[model samples]
Target: MRGFGDAAVEEVPDPVAGPGEAVVDVACVQPSVTECMLLAGEPIAMHTVLAARLAEGPVRFGGHEFAGVVRALGPGAPDGIRVGDRVTAVETAPCGRCAACRASHPHACPSPAVLGFTGPGAFAEQVLVPARTLVRVPDGVTAAQAAAIQPLAGALHGHAAAAVHPGDSVLIIGAGVMGVLHTQVARHGNAGLVMVSGRSEAKRELAGRAGADLVMDAVGDVEAAVLAATGGVGADVVFEAAGAGTFELAARCVRRGGTIVMVSVLPDHAGAPLARLRERGITVVHPRSGGGVFEHALRLVARGDVDVDCLISHRLAGVEALPEALAITRDKQRYGALGPAQVDLFDWDRAA
Candidate 1:
């Protein structure tokens, strides 16, 4: 990104692997909703860092959610990694010397290196990543599926935080990528009833197809519908995937002492109904990252437990289509897209 909103394809020097790093030839990459928001000047979490980067001139941005073939491994790279292996990586790696890491809570590391945000990402033909972050792609999973499974991993993290029981009712707010993934995960995890609230007709249909037993219109009385569905109680767990103005709604829809997982990357100053939540004894969980569950997410995809490919509504060929892909992903409703827009850099079937 040259400026706040400018992006164009240009030749840059190919990345070289350093010690404990590996160079991956990207096969499939997708522009995340968060990345698009940042590019569009939304004051989300990474706005400050990205603004600082743009001040320096054109920045190589995006492509954390990707899959590729290992092209080269630096000295001290893990023994398991090899050239020609298909893989995807955990985007965040904790700094081992940090207090959180030293205390065995690496997921809480405050100064972790984020793949697409902290350095050069896989938006190019090749990207360099820490070898330790790489996870070998299973035999049956497609490159596209690998590239898109990061959000599913995040849904898994949120489900774990909610500690959902077999019969717990799940309510997901927003029928975007994260919301649909959370719906599928809830169904597969044995949740007795699954409900989704969405503003658009297309997304509501998508939520139903993703296994939501009930889909409610977000413009209507979603809380009343959820309450009626749960026999005047409320959903046992609510995943607040919609950004900004939906936290209070999530609180209202969840039963007392139930869980609400904030799955969206909301702005820092976004308000929450703290007093109401406290009075009801609601547990609000903010899942930091999908750090430890990449492998499990891959297994779900490989086993056909979750359908990741169906969510991909737009696919453009080659890295040159990144700008279009970004546009579609940023405004999915305008593009009628159900998931992140994927850009295929190479034919995975023919790649070495």
Candidate 2:
């Protein structure tokens, strides 16, 4: 993105694999709606930082969730990573040489390289990634499935952070891709009752099909329904995946001493229900991305435990379709998109 609300495909130099890095020939990529909001320069903390950097010059923007073939290995790249191997890479990794790493606090590393946001992402035909971040695509997992795994990994992280026990009631405050993924995770973990709240009937239906025990109309009395379903005690865990204003709802719906996992990135000034949370002794958990969740997510998708196919709502062909695909991703509500807009980099011959 060149500036706020600006996105385009332009000729740029192909990236070279630096030491410890590898270049990937992207087979496919999924455009994130959250990244689209960031490209438009929303005041969200991370996006604000990115926008400041963009003020200096054009940056290769987006395509964090992608899958591809290994094109070349840089000096000292793992011998196991060979050309033509299918893989997907983690988008962000802490710089191991940072002070935080020396202190055994890698998560607090002052300088983290975030693909698509902090550096050139996979929006183009090729992208450079740290070779260490690459995970081989397991047999039977399609390129599209691999491309969509990052967020699934994120959902996994959120589920783990919630620390839900067996027979717990789970309330998800949105029925978008992340919400439904959370629903599936909860169901697989043996949650007693899994409920989803969504504004659109289509998303509600999708959530039900994705294993939600009850789909509550987000526009209606969601809290009442959730409380009623749980014998007026409320859910044991609430996942606030809907972004911004939904945090208040999650806070309100969680049982006393229950957990509310903040899954969405929010703007700096989104109001918090501190008083209510404190009074109820609700535990709020914020899980960051990383630490091998990608590997676990791939295994789940490969084993058919998490159905990524249900999340994908649209598929377009080739890099040329990138602009239109991004537009569709940005207007997800209009498109009824439960997941990111997908673009196929391969199979153009068949597409043609």
Point to the candidate with the largest lDDT.
1
* lDDT for each residue of candidate 1 in 1-352, tens digit (9 for 90 to 100): 8877798888989999999999999999999888998888889998998899889888888889999999999999987889999999999989889888999998888888888788889888999999999999999999999999899999999898889999999999999889889999998996999999998788788789989999999999999999999999999999999889999999999999999999988887999999999999999998866455999999999999999987898999998999999999988888888898899989777864
Candidate 1 regions exceeding 4 Å error are: none
TM-score for each model: 0.97, 0.96
lDDT accuracy of residue 212 in candidate 1: 92
Per-residue lDDT tens digits for candidate 2, residues 233-340, read 999999998888899999889999999998877888889989999999999998888858888999999999999998888998888888888888888888777678
**Relative to the true structure, how large is the alpha-carbon lDDT of every model?**
0.91, 0.87
RMSD versus native structure for model 1:
1.2
lDDT of 1: 0.91
